[model samples]
Target: MITSPDNDNNRDEPMVFIVIAKAYETEGGQPIDLHVMLTAPDDDTAVRLTLNALSEEGFLEADLDQIGMITGAPDEEPHASAYQGALEGEVAIIRFA
Candidate 1:
């Protein structure tokens, strides 16, 4: 979990963010998808933290840009399958009604 510092008047509670990384195998160019959960104060911070974490783990940023989605509420479980194969590959924060 990564978070900005809390100030006297603002308390930033941790929120769950889903991260999907498109990783390729070193041997045959096979693609392995990764679905992960990250905790942060907000969606933007979540993406930044996720990118940092992935980079530390040796995943390239270009490969990572393939898929990134923030799903579920702070108390809800994320459904990773629902957003698979998304073409746009844009950053999204989705909440159920």
Candidate 2:
């Protein structure tokens, strides 16, 4: 799990978010999905970061139109399972002081 820097003095730092997106491969292929946990000052920043990462990895902007959900920091219990199994990808969490 990648994590952003922590500044104890800053109380207004951005919270982390879990971004889940799914889109069909090509025009009729099977659906592809991604689960990423990232930190940003807000939802918009998180989405932008996710998009940039995806694009860097060859995912087109047109293919990302089918976002399933963008949720704020989830509780620990449910997220614990995400850490298990094979790792798909990882991103450092960003925190602003």
List the candidates' TM-scores in order. Answer: 0.44, 0.47
Clashing pairs in 1: none
Model 1 root-mean-square deviation: 10.9
| Candidate that would win on TM-score | 2
Looking at candidate 1, the ten consecutive residues that score lowest on lDDT are 82-91
Report lDDT (CA) for all predictions: 0.48, 0.50
Q: Mind giving the per-residue lDDT tens digits that candidate 2 earns over 46-88? A: 6787777666665553233332233343346435444321123
lDDT of 1: 0.48
Q: Write the per-residue lDDT of candidate 1 for residues 8-64, one digit (tens) a residue.
A: 746443344566566543544655566656555666776676566655665554244
